[model samples]
Target: MRFQIDPNDRKPLGRTGETVPAIGIGTWRINNYSMAETALIRAIEVGMNLIDTAEMYANGEAEKLVGRVCRIIGRDRVFIVTKILPDRFSDQSKVIKALEASLRRLGTSYVDLVLIHWPRPGISIEKQIQFLEATVEAGMARFIGVSNFGVENLSRAIRATKKHEIVANQVKYSVLDKQVEKDLLGFSIENKILIQAYTPLEWGGVAKNETVISIAKKYGKTPIQVALNYLISRPMVMAIPKTERVERVEEFRGSMGWRLGAEDIEILEKI
Candidate 1:
């Protein structure tokens, strides 16, 4: 089925001067190449175009799968994001090499966004940011950001980048994981950086929440849809939820078109 594009579903991808869908597909532990390709193709066919993967996920097989689907669907129609592991960020040369390999596997010359997968101990955040900047300079990535970054890590990255803006910080965020809301969300919004929420479903935990279930019933939606709407309802936030089943992609699409009411949001926040 052809996916309908919801104009209201788009959000700014940090300072990149680009807008992407608030709901995206996350490829983690998708080892079966054929299944990954089919599921991602269906997702893009349904207007969920912000596709996220990592070199660390399935040892780059996920990237390969994303590449295959992007090739089939036309890459320009999607906002592609991938991460470089923390270990590779230790040195500038290693960072470049890893990204080149990622590009090769992705079958794209440039990705919309590339993120530092995590922070490493003893490695200067400034140095890693510098290498990320170099990737953009080299035209390997259009934007650079971090994943699993805290306030201090984000501050260091922003201070370190000389030319480019740290456009996003991918982190675990959901009704169940409010750690980022305590400070990271506020900080990201203040700086015009997008908060790309991974595991927005909390690995299906939100689907079983009593509050989410009741809210879902009120909206004639599933608890998962209620949980996803809650996150994307907030400004400057987007969710990348992962699933191996193509049917779940359709369920995720249901989260769009409507939003949780103010009272429902307040009730969820209390949980």
Candidate 2:
């Protein structure tokens, strides 16, 4: 399917002065590496510019696929985001080496954004933040952020990064999972940080919801589209929904270019 992208269908990437597509592609459990390449390329062709992956995903095979696809698609056309494992954040040297390895696997000199996959217990957030700053200074990554981070961890990460600001916080967010809504969402808005919402479809849970189905019917959209649109409808929010099938990639592209009405949003919110 061919998708026409609207220039206004972009959101600010924190303070990076960059705007990315509100609906992005996520690669996790893309076990079929070959199929992932096709889906990702198709996603980009449909104007999905933000591609999310992690070193831990499929033992780095996902990054390799993304690298290959990005090369084919022209790296400049898309925003690349990947994360480092928390265990590697314990030592600064390990952190640097891990990033270098990730770069090599990704076939790129630098990534647009790098994130701490998760906060390691008993590790100094300040030290890790310092290493992240070093990556920026070394030109290994243009921007740095964290994932699955709570409010306290996010606050500490910001305080620790003396040189750079935490550009985004990637976490599991959906109509069903509003854990971040309790505080993190508000905090992120106040701090000018973007919220990259993963699992916006709630791992397929939303597809079976009666309310979402009704909403989709009313909007003449699929349930998944309704779910993704709801997440990216808010300011400073982006949705990265994953699928290895090329057809599903096209389906995700349908989430943009429109919005949910206030009453519809409230109806879904109550579910």
Candidate 3:
């Protein structure tokens, strides 16, 4: 399929003016640390411009692998995204320290987006936003957001950080779990906070679904392509599908070009 920048709403991840691919490549499960750099190289060669990782993923090995690949290719070509653990919120210095560690591990000076991994219980929301604002001011990250935040938490974050822009919310989005659809999805679209889908493949479950298989056959595509296409069709939504094989990366890239028909979209809606 054709690969190019999609014509969807290219909202800013924050005020950094860096626009990303509506579909990204998430490096969460490709856990062979020995081959992580090779996997990253394969991803970049195939056309994945967005790479999502986290400080906690493999105890930071993922970042190190991504760093090596980025250094070899030049950082300008890839949009690197990672999140900070919520427990570190009370101490703003920990936020900076964690980021510095991530930077050192990734061998990069700045990250495209840094999200609060999750909204931990008992921590003041104000402290979270304060650390994020301070993070941006210190140039540790360009944009800030939260992951796994509900509508109420998202609203609270927005309200708490009215002075600082909250760009997006990274959450567990897939055909199987549409909790965000209840309200978080619609609210985020209206508020200009892009919804970044983490496990766009249904966590390996979509591959066996008959409906997805049938749709893929009709489109002459793979099941993963259909699932990813469905997610990308929605406004302000991006899918980050993780895979190690070059062919699989190409398949994820394949989902970006064609527009799913209305009937097909409706069919996938029930999925």
* Over 4 Å off, model 2: 1-8
> TM-score for model 3?
0.92
What lDDT tens digits, residue by residue, belong to model 1 across residues 56-168?
98888889888888889998987899999999877899999999999999999999899999987788999989999999999999999999999999998999999988988
Best by lDDT: 1
Number of clashing pairs per prediction, in order: 0, 0, 0
Tens digits of per-residue lDDT, candidate 2, 1-271, equal 0111223568888887988888888999876878888989998888897899999998888888888997899988778999999999778889899989888888999999999999888888898889788889999999999999999999999999888889999999998887777788878877878899998987899899999999999999999999988888776788999998899988888888888887788787777
State the C-alpha lDDT per candidate: 0.87, 0.86, 0.79
Off by over 4 Å in 1: 1-8
**Model 2 C-alpha lDDT versus the unseen true structure:** 0.86
Instruction: Tell me the tens digit of each residue's lDDT in model 3 across 1-271.
Output: 1122234634346444556677777878675655656666777776667789999988898888789888898898778889888878768889899999999998989998888999978888877887888888988787788898888888888888845688888888876666767787778767878889888887778878898899899999988888888777776688888876666777787887777777777776676
Q: Name the Cα RMSD for model 3.
A: 3.6
Question: Sorted by lDDT, highest first, which candidate order results?
Answer: 1, 2, 3
Q: How many backbone overlaps does candidate 2 show? A: 0
**Cα miss at 252, model 2 (Å)?**
0.9
- What's the lDDT for candidate 1? 0.87
Worst 10-residue lDDT window for candidate 1 reads 1-10
